[model samples]
Target chain A: MHINMKIATKYIVVAILLVGFTSCQKNSRPNYQYMPNMYEPIGYEAYQESDAFANGVEAQLPAEGSIPRGNFMPYEIEDTNEGYELAKASLTNPLDSTQVDFVRGKELYDVYCGICHGNKGNGQGKLVQREKILGVPSYDDAGRAITTGSIYHVIYYGKNTMGSYANQLNEEERWQVTAYVEKLKAELEK
Target chain B: MKHVIYRNLTSRILSLGFIILLTVSTSLSAQEGDVAKGKSLFNANCAACHKLNKPMTGPALANVEQRLIEEEGLDREWINNWIRNSSALIKSGDAYANKIYNEWNQVAMNAFPQLSDQDITDILAYTAAPPPAPVVVDAGADAVVQEPGISNDLILGALAVLFALLALALVLVKRTLNRFAEAKGIDTVIEEKRTPIWKAFIQNQFLVLVTAIFFLLASGYFVYGYFMQVGIDQGYEPVQPIHYSHRIHAGDNAIDCKYCHSSARVSKHSGIPSLNICMNCHKAIGEVAAETQQEGLKEYGVDYNAEIQKLYEAVGWDGTGYTGETQPVKWIRIHNLPDFAYFNHSQHVSVAGLECQTCHGPVEEMEIMYQHSPLTMGWCINCHRETNVKVKDNGYYTKIHEQLSKKYGVEQLTAAQMGGLECGKCHY
Candidate 1:
């Protein structure tokens, strides 16, 4: 009787464990990591609070006028109408025609500008076409005919109804986008 | 009485004819440039501030010429001057201009010094025309968009139901057979002392051997699987600080994934986007949409508006400039590789041109982000083995392709054939 009881208990335990294993669903909780230190490194995450730091600041701003290595040349134009006028009058692309990669520029443009400005640069993008945003103009329009400097200026310090893309794109990338926009504008005019 | 009725009908008809004639003459005279030309011009200059049917940063410009003339006592010349330079008008202390400026939150209308009188007239003409009816793109898009969320629960439920029915049928059959045996006066029940399970198991060597082997194999397999699960986080979905729906941003709105994950093309990590990136659109779209709010967040079980409030708190944006009291959004990281394993996002994303969804598992459909792939070494090696090196257009691969194709004696070479499995390729 005792042996039978022991066998019965063992089977019951086994059955319960098997049920528990199957019943526990995927995405219920995070499964155990063997060595968490390996999975989650000892390195500090960007913008994460650390015990070593006071006031919980990790990503500190660089000194004013400092530039990262291999980045674009520093843009001097400030975010102002006078600055835009100055850029338009004087600033030409440092990159020549050969330096421009319209393909890369198109890729960047699609990511950033094609939502509001149509893929064809015809001002009928998904946002404008849906009437979510009004008044995006075609590049071919006489009043909206833009130069490289004007495009760069607007990208650097956003114009009316558009926000600054400076944070999202580096200086070189902004130029790439400008080159692409010029291509689109030329195409529309043609 | 009949003669009086006829006279009344005739007078009414004459009045209607006169009104129609007046409308026809005004429309004829009011026509300016080609309406199409006017529309293009309007989109360029006037669209930034004005909507024809609704008010935006500037007043609704429907019947704008009439309104400005009749209501505000401003003529075409005054309107033309205002278009050229509203700032000058406001500075000159024009009461109407100042009032307009003050009403519009003092956002100065940009000067159109380049605009000719004809250009302004064309824009005015476009505005005078009736607003176009909004076009609704097909309902078929939404209907076709939803991929069936297939899971194993359906199969499991069916199996459970089948087993229950089978058990019921078996029990009933057994009882019926026993009663029939008794009715036939056949001795079916032995009524002997039952053998202990262990003893019975021991007696049946074949059964014991099979069960032992199965147990041994199953346990061995289970133990191996458990050990393999060490660094493999297949479904490690942690609750994020805020509920940011990829479905809404990436799926429904068709926002490019790279817009948020900008660094994936250039950097090592598929970097988390900064809060400023979120602000690009969120500044305009402050609240959770009414329809989206109705559908509760299934994964986090959090309210939609409450999530927006959390974002507001993180960015310290009170619908205007920064409030200075800010907290960074600390999203729980889902995919993490070991420190020794080096995975360059640019190498796979930019150079190799693998879609983010290839590794990320249809992120557009994901409401809450989770680790869809196992992120296992085996998974990586398998992909490298199967995937072909795209060598057609890329200049960098041309020389390598010639040599590798010669070496392998094949027309097309896979990633593995090009030394993708070399230890230094990943480990270093």
Candidate 2:
């Protein structure tokens, strides 16, 4: 019986030791790298931190008067009431009828705008339905009849509660979404 | 007969009086507006810009009529006109209207020309309604819930104590037996000792060889496992600066992955969303819902609202607008490939049209994000070897795909057949 007790005590000690060793492998920290130098980049990576810049971040805004490469057109409309009105009245879509791809437009719209402005553009979005956001006007709202130009302007400059989606969607993509919004608005009106 | 006629006439007059009283009371209530109807109206119309307690795009509208009457000396007529058409009111050179328009950065309020006087009354009633009481965490309920866990340990302890008592009793009984035997002058039996089990086992050459071989194999297996997982961080879960719950955003809200990771559709990297993107929704949502806050505290041991406050501080939003002071969040990158690897997010996410969850592994369900896949070269190659190339709707590559399939003599072409296995494709 004494020998059996000794064996049992030894087994318990072994079990405790195993638990301790396994518990030491915490998931909160990263695993040990064989060679960190090879894994880490020497050049400045996206969102890297560095002391070279004034802000100490690798990402920087474009210099003043710098133009992006590729087919780009600068928007002259200022972010003001007058600017909004002007854009709403005059800023027609540059893309001709043939260039409008409804499928791609729908895809982009669903990702960005459909969260707040319902996919059907009736203002009953997920956030609104969940009571997180409210008072999103429907596309077919007659009081503020949204034209294609106004849609693009609103997307670019972001009216009232909405934030500017210019960073997320490019000028061409913005036009695409504008076209889709018009389509949704027409459907809502029907 | 005359007395009966007088009694009937008196009863009829009382019934007429009661009908008049009911009509008056109902009319008074209609003018006051139903609180339930007002709440729905407020949420649907005024809620986007005007919150009851907080300043949003518009100012807080709690008891707005009384506050306006006292502070701005504006009446119900002025509010009615403003609600119908604020820009018109401003154009008409109304002093308070112009002041408010300028104060709110001239963001024109949408004209609710369709709203009747009754609708306005209902909305005003909603704004005037008293705020709901704060939810109190019930300590008694918490204690009740905790009882079962404590009882489990208590039960274990009780069993242990019972076994110890049994052991002690047996020991005492044995001592008594020995003492009795001694008192009676009787001998206790003793067994002659032989070679111990270990010594006897060591003497058996075949058994010793087999045990040694078994130990060697076991050790080798363990060593191989340890070495194999040296650089593969499959289950790496690091603590972030702010506790962002993807479960709440993606799973509960059902927001698409591409909503925040917008660049993944066009760019090489699935970039972390900027603070502006967070502000898109969080500007209105300063704090989480009460139930969500409770859930975070009870389940995850986190105050979700405090994390939102951290985000606001980082973004430098002083409740209403940007303060022009921003700090970039230092997010720890997970699932990073080595410097030599060349992975383009747009290629797989957009062109190939693969769901983000295919690689991310149900990111919506994760409370704290972790590396779900091993992300090893073998893992990547194995997927490439099995997954068929998405060739449908690719008119540009239809001829090439057909030719390739014909060359391979297969009905469907795997990504490997489309040069996905080329070392230069990923390495260079």
Candidate 3:
């Protein structure tokens, strides 16, 4: 009777252990979500391809030359040498000194330009240090006597070897970055 | 003494070479404007369309003087004339100039009427100058040999040995006890003479009932727990189109999360990076190192070069000009909140100033990215209840902050107190 009891207890313990072990740990399978239809609503997801849209397009941009409300005046300078010269000669930031937040500007600049233009603006960014890119000039370098307009122009239509950050950063953010870069340039000059 | 003489000779040779180089550079500077002046002129006038060593819209100007004078038999004066009026030269049917125009697709060179002969010569000097060597290059991530400490396997082996030794000791003690009992003339089988435990247990009805009830309750609790965890996908790591390692980029290289996912601060969704953004870095960093190949990548059986090749193919970059043929990488979306739920990355990441890891878990450590959080409503509500609203320094939260602090009667307020738990806030 004792032998029988011992065997039965061992079996029960093993069974309980197996069940417990199976239930534990992170699982790849998802738990049941009720009303799965509510989970996947029939709405326009940006990149999700569906035949619901015309030309089988996913995301659509607004038509060209239409400005949204509460936006700053659009840049009129063409992406040409003439335009660069024009901007360098005349274009100025509309945001006054009070509106220009150096803290936010620094944050934006670090994100967008610091990868290539160094956090300190010494032209020794990580990519440059790693030999991934060469010949990024310092702000204090004699070759590039860039003005605020020139910086704005560069951000809008990128200079040589540099891609435009227009898609990544908006106009306000771009102006902020320009302000921060100007600050760095002043520091380097000092 | 001979070794010392040889070392001295070598040092002399090196110094002589350096002196000759310095003189030549100085003479060239004298011939043109100084090299620095040439560099400035080149950058101001020519950098838009030209490179020193690489062909962009215009041919590289490396050894342009030598090539033009020696190879093409063109006049030294023609370069000045060409820079000043390339279209005029091409139109005038100057054989060499037209040959040049035809060689490259008939793209008109920009007229730099402002540049003097000295500026042109300096630009040429700057272009011919060899590129400066990299001053600093730290050995990238793979060189450090981390000393691995006592692994789980070693601990497990030691534990198994200890357990066996303990079992043996216990058996030996039992045998000794039995022997002692036998020597005392007390039968060791006295244990067997007692009623069997199961029989005794069965005979006590009240004890059996209580024991049965406790077991049923425990089993029921476990069964419910197992069922409750049915659809919550905690670790659903799907394969992405590219084997992009967040550990390598975000962790090893320490690239900021927002560098690639730039739209996260502004938009509803944390945007997938466009191919152009990838090109910004990948245009130069084309392949992974052999050391990385042998490390984590080897364990996963991934070929790094092939994955890079896939990126090149998608982006239509053949190492030179973009072919303009492109295809979007079909990355499998992992995190899918149900339609009823509303989650804005800007609201959490930008407004609240939460770290990416708060919801994404330790993404920098994940080789294959996964959904780390349960991402259920309970998870969201729990976070809202616990998290304090970040109200300082934001212009958007000015009026809201004053009212919230007054209502709650606290300086610092949790998200729940700020109406984060309102059903319409997330649901509608």
Model 2 segments more than 4 A misplaced: A1-24, B1-31, B137-190
lDDT of 2 by residue, B186-292 (tens): 88776788999999999999999999999999999999988888888888898999999999999998889998999999999999999998988988899888778
Report how closely model 2 matches the true complex, as a DockQ value. Answer: 0.67
Per-residue lDDT tens digits for candidate 3, residues A40-103, read: 7787886787786674657656789889789768888988766877898898887899989999
Which one wins by DockQ: 1 or 3? 1
lDDT of 1 by residue, A35-93 (tens): 66766656775555777666575666687888788745888887765687788777887
- What candidate 3 gets wrong by more than 4 Å, as runs, is A1-31, A54-57, A80-86, B1-211
lDDT for B331 (candidate 2): 94
- Over the stretch A60-130, how does candidate 2's per-residue lDDT look in tens digits? 88998888999899988998888888888999999999999999999999989998898998888898899
In CAPRI terms, model 3 is classed as acceptable
TM-score of structure candidate 3: 0.68
Q: State the weakest 10-residue window (summed lDDT) of model 1 chain B.
A: B141-150
Interface RMSD of 3: 5.8
